[model samples]
Target: MAAEQGKVDPMHQFAIEPLFGSAHWEIAGYNIAFTNSALWMAIATVALWIFVAGGMKRELVPGRWQMAVESFTGFIDDLLEANVGKAGRKYVPYIFSLFMFILFANLLGLIPLPLALAGVHPFTFTSHFTVTGVLAILSFAIVLVVGFWKHKLHFFSLFVPHGTPLVMIPLIFMIELVSFMIRPFSLGLRLFVAMMAGHVLLEVLSSFVIDGLNAGATFGLIVSLPSFLLMIGICALEILVAGIQAYVFALLTSLYINDAENLH
Candidate 1:
């Protein structure tokens, strides 16, 4: 209906607009400007810093904030250390920060305010690829670092299984190598896709909710009802996705590091 009204942009779903552009810095011919992605990332960083800092002052009988912080970090730290062993303790900060950043970014979007309300920068923070893509690359780099640190010359053996036949060695090596290379791609794409997809659903539903009220069509009312309900459902699921994706990314990174350490 909004499509018929000609108010909605068809390609607004994936557009990442730059706030301002300049020759601030260049990497690989791409100029680094203050973009929406960068802005939200900064917001995420500041928000996380403040949120965690507020809980940093611990007491013997911890308050809600202190307890929450302790529990959150303890859970991730324990899980990683248990599965990945003592060496994995080195990654506690990285994993914990990743989970917290994503959780804040996801929750930030759920802030209820009028769509036309000024001073709101939802687009800057939500589902921005540059922010997420860099995070993915960071995970990839950590795996590489840990693998090399632990296994030295033998880490390359990850490309070949221990019991593979000589005839199948080359093909298996290629397969494992490709799969290894694709981990970052899969990780980044999954999180970015989930964030983007969820926001798109929310926006489309909101459009229906608005248009239905305007048109007074019975079908519009029906569509709007489910759209509102689905928006609520997606919001809840997105909260889970936010934390889970961050955890999965960290978990996989730790496992890869462990594999590099064990090399078997």
Candidate 2:
């Protein structure tokens, strides 16, 4: 049933609708449901595979896919080298993967059908805060892991300022520690909130436009159309944000790791 009819369960909005489910099918006692996110992920994987495979067997002069992939790879390489130095080269794969996953996910959501699916189920298990939150925390953990792994106990000394008063050492350490702990929280919140709020705003604005048109109020309809258009522009902006947030997460992570490796 359509969401407008109220027959759809709002809480089930996040549930993954599989192509089919059967009594014999299971994965570790968990129902292996096929979700839109998973579908997008699979699509991303296939797209990446095709791009990479094609790039490998390209002509002497690059074709469209080859050039596009090379350009993206080179752009990332340059960004890392410029920002984090030669040492940052090692993290290129991880950063690239993060950026691609996020970029495709955001792009896929822009498709009308996927956007409609989101409205159909708002309270599904998949809609829980955990998925995106976990992704953010995972990224944060990678940064810290790389940092401390490279620096050892010396990494702990990061909290001590280079030229602080002796009396302020403890306070500085406390503040630094608290801030460090909050990194994951902030990272996760930023992505989750952005995704949720952007989707909600788009949905609400669309509803307003429809309502305005139905009411026969010319000004309201006109204004609502612009608002709807603005939402579309914002959706495009969100695509950029997805790529940016991924890059920022990786870059900051590289910075932290660099500091640790250098014992700074």
Best by lDDT: 1
TM-score for all models, in order of appearance = 0.86, 0.79
18-65, model 2: which lDDT tens digit per residue? 644543457888866665555666776677777667777557898887
Candidate 2 yields a Cα-based lDDT of 0.65
What is the clash count for each candidate, in the order shown?
A: 0, 5
lDDT string for model 1 (141-229, tens) is: 88788788877768889999989999999999999999999888887777777777777777777887777766787967687788788
RMSD of each: 3.1, 4.1
lDDT of each: 0.75, 0.65
Model 1 reaches what TM-score against the true structure? Answer: 0.86
Stretches of candidate 1 off by over 4 Å are 1-6, 10-14, 18-30, 114-116, 124-126
